[model samples]
Target: MMVEIAIFFLLIFMIIGMLFVLEIENLLSAVVMMGAIGFGLSVIFLLLGAPDLAIVQIAVEVISVVILIRATIHRDIKERADESLSNISSIPLLVCIFFFFLMIYPALRLLPTFGEPVFLNFYSSSVYYLRDGFHLTGAPNIVSAIILDFRAYDTLGEAIVLFTSVIGALSILRYRNRKKEHNAS
Candidate 1:
């Protein structure tokens, strides 16, 4: 009961943080709100008994925050106001919110009730993996077995994508530097 309440509060915090991030005009405040959201998500993961996911979330949050701060250090943090919302403009926003709730209603109804068994069958794929992962993959950790053995190819593909993105970013920056130098000379 207490755990569920804590999780609910954490989820609320995350939602509020997301809303603040979207509405804030200051870039630094938005970044900080994003970090808060990430931290809340990590805590939720921990409460859900997924320590591996929590660790990854924390590391990603830290790295992303550092990169964002470094990238925006030279730029103006305050965003220029482009448009003002009038009373008439709020009607469309209200309509959008109504439609969003309408769209989500059915999905929400399909979700299983709290403290209820989601699946009828007890011997599921997840159970099988938990039982045999160590023997099959020789990995002591179930998360490691799932990622490094069961989904090794998928992991490798993700790593390749990340590597490509970093290389692309570096090349773009390098080209910009050379262009600047040529223009200066």
Candidate 2:
């Protein structure tokens, strides 16, 4: 009873959102509508019990809306947007778009719809792993073995990427502050 009502609501919002995205003339309006679509999808995910993904979708949707809002503040929006969406593309972008969608088509169609398995057999797999593997892997902790043996390089690279991103953000912020100070002086 409740599930059907939920689906009906989701479908209604999705239909409206799709129409909004398609019918909107302004780029900003379309961006906002796309965010709405993301939010709606996030709600659907939440209803389906994927809390992590719902959070990610909400965060991404917020960022997209904020970026679109920020981009409109300084630019000559009207003049830039006077060109039709078709006119906005160059040969390079068109080729890139063609290849990007072409790349995704096979993967998107063949990919399984994402969600957790209906049943989790924790007692079987987790029990076996706990009982075995100290001799084979020569590691005391299963967590340590998984991280150090299988994914050590991946973990190291991720840590390096995080460090690099933090440094890059700090550098960019300092540069912006200095530029502002210089201009103000």
Candidate 3:
């Protein structure tokens, strides 16, 4: 009963937020609308009994929304230039959206039929005894055990390995912005 009430209120808030976001002329209003929507969706997730996903979504939404609002708040609100997004070519955009939905549909549908999962098909399931850490090993945290103790330096070394990749990507992207990049860096 309480869950249904929470869902109803969340739905109402989300609809109001969407309308505000779409109709608002001011950027700050739009940001607030979107943030409200994000927070409302987070609450909806919690009501649906997915607390883990709700926590992750809330954290990500909060950080990104704050960054967006902070950036847009400094911009000139008085500059009300009418722009036509309809003039832009939307064929490619429609095609991308269609392709994404097509891809995601099959993946979502397959989630249920994936059955007893990979471990069941394999020699023995690791998920059941993952907490034990290979029959009473010292590692309490499964992920920590896998990353730090077992794999150890393999994880730490990847950061160092990715340094060159980052530099290469930046170099490629900034080929035309050499002067700007040099000044910023």
Local distance difference test, per candidate?
A: 0.86, 0.74, 0.75
Better of 1 and 2 by lDDT: 1
Looking at model 2, residue 124 earns an lDDT score of 61
Superposed model 1: Cα runs more than 4 Å off: 81-88, 115-124, 180-185
TM-score of every candidate: 0.85, 0.45, 0.48
Number of clashes recorded per candidate: 0, 0, 0
Residues 14-73 of candidate 1: C-alpha lDDT, one tens digit per residue: 888998876778888888888889999999899888899999999999999988888877
Index of the highest-TM-score prediction: 1
Per-residue C-alpha lDDT of model 3 across residues 20-133, encoded as one tens digit per residue: 776678888888789889988998888886676688789979887887887797885742534445554669889999999998997787674422465655556355447466
- Largest lDDT belongs to which candidate? 1
Q: Is candidate 1 or candidate 3 better by lDDT?
A: 1
The all-Cα superposition gives candidate 2 an RMSD in Å to the true structure of: 8.4
Model 2: per-residue lDDT, tens digit, 1-185? 57557857997998998887666666677777888888888988888766767897999789878977777656534434344557554788889999999999999887654443323345665455446656657888765665576568987997899799879967976887798999999
How does model 3 fare in lDDT? 0.75
lDDT of 2: 0.74
lDDT score of residue 24 within candidate 2: 63
Evaluation by TM-score, superior candidate among 2 and 3: 3
